[model samples]
Target chain A: MSIASILFAALFYLAAITLAGGLAYRIADYARTPAPLKIPTTPAPTTTGGVVFRMAREVFLFESLFKSNLWIWLFSILFHFGLALVLLRHLRYFTEPVWSWVVLLQPFGTYAAFPMVIGLAGLWARRFLVERIRYISTPSDHLMLALLLAIGLSGLSMKWLVHTDVVALKTFFLGLMRFDVEPLPASGLLYLHLGLVATLMLIFPFSKLLHAPGVFFSPSRNQVDNPREKRHLAPWAAEMEK
Target chain B: MAAEITAPAYRVIPIVPALKPDAMEGVKPFVASEKIQDALGFPGTLPDDWHERAIAKMGELLKKYRSLKVYLDACVHCGACTDKCHYFIGTQDPKNMPVARQDLLRSVYRRYFTLPGKLFPKLVGARDLTKEVLDEWYSYYHQCSECRRCSVFCPYGIDTAEITMAARDILDAVGYGQKYSNEIIGKVHTIGNNLGLPGPALENTMEGLEEDVKEDTGIDVRFPIDVQGAEVLLITPSADFFAEPHIDSLIGYAKVFHAAGVSWTLSSMSSEAANFGLFIGNYEQMRKVALRIRQAALDLGVKRIIVGECGHAWRVAYSFWNTLAGIGAGADDPYALMLQKQLDQRHKQPTHICEYTWDLIQRDALKFDKTKNDHLVITFHDSCNVARASRMGDEPGGQFDIPRNIIRAVANNFVDMDENTIREKTFCCGGGGGLLTDDLLDLRVKGALPRMEALQAVVDSHGVNYLAAICAICKTQFSKTLPYYGFNMRMIGGVHQLVSNAIILENKQ
Candidate 1:
């Protein structure tokens, strides 16, 4: 196959999948019904400082995270950190000359990919093994984990086992990032890895994985726990009260 | 055919006495119209700026909580939380459904703030803030009891209650609070209680209880009020002062204290345990109401405050009093610090009302005269706020045994409701979330139907005569609602009421 055609195929396939995934996410969010309204009775701090402190406690310290099972907590931290590192490393492919840090940590990236794969596997296993966790896990949960593992393994294989022309790969990735048409080089393992990662990114927002950011927006954990002592009328109840 | 074989026309046998002419004179069946007019200023035209002011206040309140702002802005409307509500399960009304209910608050939030909502309102499913939408929010939000039951099942734990509360707060900010609620708030501010009974009235009530104690127990139980230098101040709801069931419960508290020989007095100023501010989403009001208890405790020179058997009252006392009253700063607040200090200072350990009450009954192997309560076949209704929200878990009324004990103590014919009726799955009385107003009676009756039906199922077979409930409001609601549903069951008092009836008074020579 011609180099230009291969590049074009990879670029076009990635964009299509990304767009499809993004649309699916938007649809799921729109289609999903909201849970029932529950008014918590706990006292919440009313000051701006109080609210900021609470957010900080939640985001950085995972204040509520301590409430979850220990094993789940460990796996979550590992998987999230590994996933973030891997995403950072992927930026290496889109640069003309691979970033200096990416080059320096090429070995570290390979090592980090192993844990990322293992962490995803551990999480999937734990979900299946734990009865309570298993009950809550949906089909999408298992699929996301399996897909993540595949992407990590394929990327590692392309980097460590199968030799790919680095210059050709960089050119292909940069072209895709810049919205230019380019064909991928005939690097079989690279295409497989790129295909898996691209698919996962597109599916990211739609899946339960979105809970990572969604928790912050949840009212139960975020709102202050102030009890109502004074009588305030709900506007609807005002007329009835009068 | 033998004459015996043919049953004669059945004669109506009336076993009970005929009703007296003035049987209904003093009985107040919660009237909504009067209360609505007196407290809420309802039916009258609201001020011209009311809507604008309320919406503006809502926006400001939303802005106050950056976290709430994010949550209100971030909801993807995934309906996974729909079937998780007890209210929705109890009532199939779509308005009672959480998603539809939350949409009432979320839509307004979106229209006011979000960029896409502002630019392309239709594209985002956002609509302009209208009176119709406001009415829907008002109706449905009130339907919610602010129970966190759904949060337990939610994947993201999105609390719909927060939206409801915020909505109420905004309404209050705009001068649209309900009459009953506003009146209660006014009372809490002015008289230190929702009931609006002042110090002299409280003392008089205590004196009446003292006389009742003398009549019943022979022991001249001093129901002291605001007595300085008392070791502990027992704070309870005003319902205990005059209300039927709760009054007995209050006496039960005094008896336990007397039995244990613990030094405690009721503070006339802070007789109520319930903090109504919880219903309206007003934090400052909550603090002000809670402050009375702290002030009373300090003024009376008590070492500790023992909250009474009120649901939300106990919740506020235990949960927030320490924080808001400066009784405790985080873990090291004054309530805790004082409690610890008391534990350390006293040569003997002091007991909480729950601990002391349970211990006294258990320690004495207290026997009851079932004949005193034999007039009714009673079934216990576990108050959701008390059984679920409070410290009670499994050891009897911590979750299970207390009510069972109380029921068995009262009537020989005590029968159980369905298993879910007793414990973790106990249904609310529908009067909670401050829906006890007369206008909301229909909704409350509808909500109480599930519990009523369960009670009726047993009453149909076993023939329940009385519905024993713990919380005062539950008792009040049951007394009114049960009769409406064609069930002739009387609202029996709490465990303490049973204790008062059953406990043999020492013979006065």
Candidate 2:
């Protein structure tokens, strides 16, 4: 294997571990922290089933954002859904004899890159165009958007602009999954795409991207509105009783 | 100061105003004095090591409350909640925006707590917690009403109220507490109520109310206090005993109990339902204040505990009372189980007065003379805390529907304000979350802009002559700010007051 293959292999391993282990630690932190009171925004679900439905609407439908702004909701849905498809399509590399669904999703996911890029552009444009959004945005906000946009554009370039050896690239990724080493494709564009994806995974736990897991733990969205029926006692709060 | 302030014009639709940076920078509530701080178990004054204390407090809170840690990290600055704040609409201040208001604390939280902020503070907009940043937290956090309107719109449910509460909690820990909330909390701790109304004085006010009701309706509606062995214990804000429209609601509660023939009494121990401890965001203090109700419940041996019309009060009672004081069921703790067994469980452990009245109205237990309120064309202003924070009855959105149901039953003409400004999207009374002090009157007048504009639309189209609210703070805030916008302060009244106007007594001559 070339030095580049060895370096990329090590980088991917580190990124993967960071993504998995970091998320595990952060998620454990959230779960362990006690929500002392039931503070679901009113008109919230009374039952566990109802709360599941509420969360489903919020997660899948962007229910609250849809209520807030049409433009933001449209762009957010485009970016998130398109990214989901693209990520799913990328799964073909890891599975030998790729799943039938992955085979079916190949064409649609390739096209999804356009909407993903367009959505990121619209969201990034608002950071400059909208005054309130501009005021609240930091350098990191702009960079996060730029990073995603760069990743999408580079990934697309490999397919349409500068074609790379997909079979060899898949072998390299599949090799990374196991202990065996394989030669990486010499395309800088492929390296750029992989590098950005690795960066996103590395930062996922520490950054605002924690919202992915944070939403599931949010008391206002996830809690059942049954404070009157059940007593929610935190360990620390309960300790005060003794 | 009053002469210098001008209320925003009434717009048909509340247009998000142009950003005015630092417009409300000078507005800050008076700092709590040593006596008040000590009474509430906070530092007597701003400690010498306040910066360290504040940071330590934030760390402590992050572990204690999931809402704080999640919210501080979850915000991606989507700007969904930017125009959602009434203070932003009213003052046109960028800092008043919910996301920006949260960043006042979140920026500091990021700086000290997170790795990226420590490595590259400028990139993430994190800043060291300086005196200037602390001052900003004091000014802007007080401006928020803790209404949770922004939370209704946030994709992640990033409640600025939770952040505000945490910021205020940290502020108190460093001995930099706001006078209004801290003093009120002190009063609740020492005097058993926010107003410090003595038991004898409360009895005097009740006697005056009884006489007035007798004169008007020729019925002896009793306002009993400290009566043990009653079927229900009524815990209401002290404002009900002293303030207009609020006092009228007091009379209304009395008439309802009189007509229903349910035995009820108020307790001096927990005379105040409005918990300022909630405003300061101190769990210990909030729980301390709430324990009075449990003590009252035990002493009075009341079968039911029903709270009167006060928004945050009802929220504390409805949402947090069970957790804080064990007023609700499904607990194994000795204290919670003890109170749970003592109180009647057939009804909601602590029911809102609106829920109580609506249940009676639905069962055809209460009679009403709708014509009594026919003279006034009415619209209900859903109090922010009650609308967004608490629920009533068994169904969801019961808080919104129950009050409107009671209004339609009592009043012949009823109209609602703009759909955007009512229900879960309700605007603050501009004076909620301890911003009602005289020092913050300018901020109050400015923050009332969106709500006042919404009321103006109804008045223009539906000829709304009276704006009824179900919160003591909303009633009091509107009564003060209405005249500034060329509306009569008398236009502000309570839902129960409307019920009082129309409620017919069986024994009245």
Candidate 3:
């Protein structure tokens, strides 16, 4: 019933609204835009099933980037999969009587922070170390890396050094998920972690984080290499026919 | 030996040119003259409200193309594709890096459209639409050949070709069109080809080709022109009518038609297959040039349309022609529907000449004496457009293999260049996408470095004396730039040029 707890709860709701609504609008805008040509990068799949498989390799494996540079690929895949595992771990905070699988993943997800932080550090180094990468890095690019690094390091600090009231933290997150409001923990560590998470959510809709959803809508990856087999005409382009 | 044109002692292609930071600085093509710009229906010069109009055009295109919009947003600047561009590798100008080139437009796009750009432009590397920004667009966008080599390496498949095209389209909208492509497109409209050969000149050139073939092999291979009711209408580059290595490929096509007994005629109306409309990224101009092919096809009453060895033209014909001018199937309207009903469904409506010749070699319908090409050790330079943008012979990698298969079938000694440098990962010939003009000759010479390095490796080991290509631009580029790399210029030619060297012209049993 503390004022800080109530304010934090309201902030979470606002963050959730912005993340969901902004992403929805951005995605709708992307879907509404017409891809006027079939421009799948070559040696690409010819069938719908093959395209799905190809996309799976790209999303899961970063196949093209793997072919490009081994150094970047290793760091990228490690960071992404580690983040995915850690996200699964965070699900325990919102679910009551956490699922048995979530209980099982607790230790492995805790250890995933190593790759997550190390991977981010490696990528950050390339922003300064690699000549080509250094030349192209904007201020926002380094800022994005620093932000992610802060989140990862702070979360690890809570796990290793500062022990917060985890039971109350779960209660607070679960209350936010449900309509019932509960008091948040009074630990500064807890406040810092929740604050950074909320900031990422707020920026998610506007930032380069759109790459996550934007990759799926990329015409080059999504389109089948069948321009010769099928005549793909956008609606506006089809108007030209008449 | 065709002719001795030895390479210079100084190496224009020295191990990928050592990445000099500003090796190709301030290199830009001449601006399109007002007359040429007006011919393509673009503004003759920059109007007073050019900035607003350019931004408005970018906004329209962003809404119209998901590729452009998504590519603009999706690039993470991970630099995965930083070293992939041939121009960047060859010139070492950081701006030539695909991501940097994309960022040129993306910064402007972000500033005007995205929130971060509007609020805090410096942080996001976004800038206002200004004269300097417009100049960078003109310089860097043209530096790109629209080859899509960057897309092959991008993790998200962010095609810089798509971005380059969109940028070029925006530039053209604001009256900053390049002279090379716009002027060539104007000529194609007026005189039926890029060379501006009138009907009389075209007819006379074909006559001269027929006589030359008779003297060479005692074969009366007819180079028919605008013949009514020919079985196939050959849409080749006008350069094939006059240029050295290109003209040889023309004779090869003529000989193939004669040997196969398939009647094919060159169109006086749509004689050129190199559509500069695609080069300038003008959809209407591309469509207008493409419509000539369809019109000629209808008038001549050809059953099939076989495209000549041109890179972007095949991309247009295979990909956009169906959508643009109804040259292929899947059209609903009367214009496309009529052609669909009239043209032969047995063959691809717009088939590649390589696919045509390969089918003959596959069917054993054509005969080649391998010993005839024993003097040459051949290798194939996969044309960028055919390898990446288009397909051949109904399979996914048919574009890569069919040409190689044809080369192996014709030549006694055939070896592929470095494996990574061939196929879908092929480099541009440096002269593609309207860079073939003299103004960008430095870029043309420099961009040939990676490809020349790959060719030199083969020459040092396997002695690949002939670098056969399928694109007219590739042939012209290598012919010009090869001598600078200490290789003979005549060593570069079309894949069919090899076929012409080895094919027995006599009626074979």
Best candidate per TM-score, number? 2
Q: What tens-digit string does per-residue lDDT give for candidate 3 at A14-109?
A: 999999999999999999999987788877788999999999999999999998888899989878988988999988998879989999999989
Please give the C-alpha DockQ score of model 2. Answer: 0.89
Cα lDDT tens digits for candidate 3, B421-475: 8998888988888889877777887788788888988999998898998888998
Give the C-alpha lDDT of model 3. Answer: 0.87
Candidate 2: residue pairs that collide: none
The regions of model 2 sitting more than 4 angstroms off are: B1-3, B11-13
B-chain TM-score, every candidate? 0.79, 0.98, 0.96
Looking at candidate 2, what is the lDDT of residue B334?
Answer: 84
DockQ of each: 0.08, 0.89, 0.74
Q: TM-score of model 2 relative to the true fold?
A: 0.99
Q: Of the candidates numbered 1 and 3, which has the greater TM-score value? A: 3
- DockQ order, best first, reads 2, 3, 1
Which portions of model 1 show Cα errors greater than 4 Å? A1-211, A216-242, B1-56, B63-91, B328-352, B361-379, B392-416, B460-466, B504-509
Look at candidate 2 and tell me the lDDT of residue B172.
88
Our tally of clashes for model 1 stands at 51
Q: How many angstroms is the interface RMSD of candidate 1? A: 12.9
Candidate 2 chain A: worst-modelled 10 consecutive residues by lDDT: A172-181
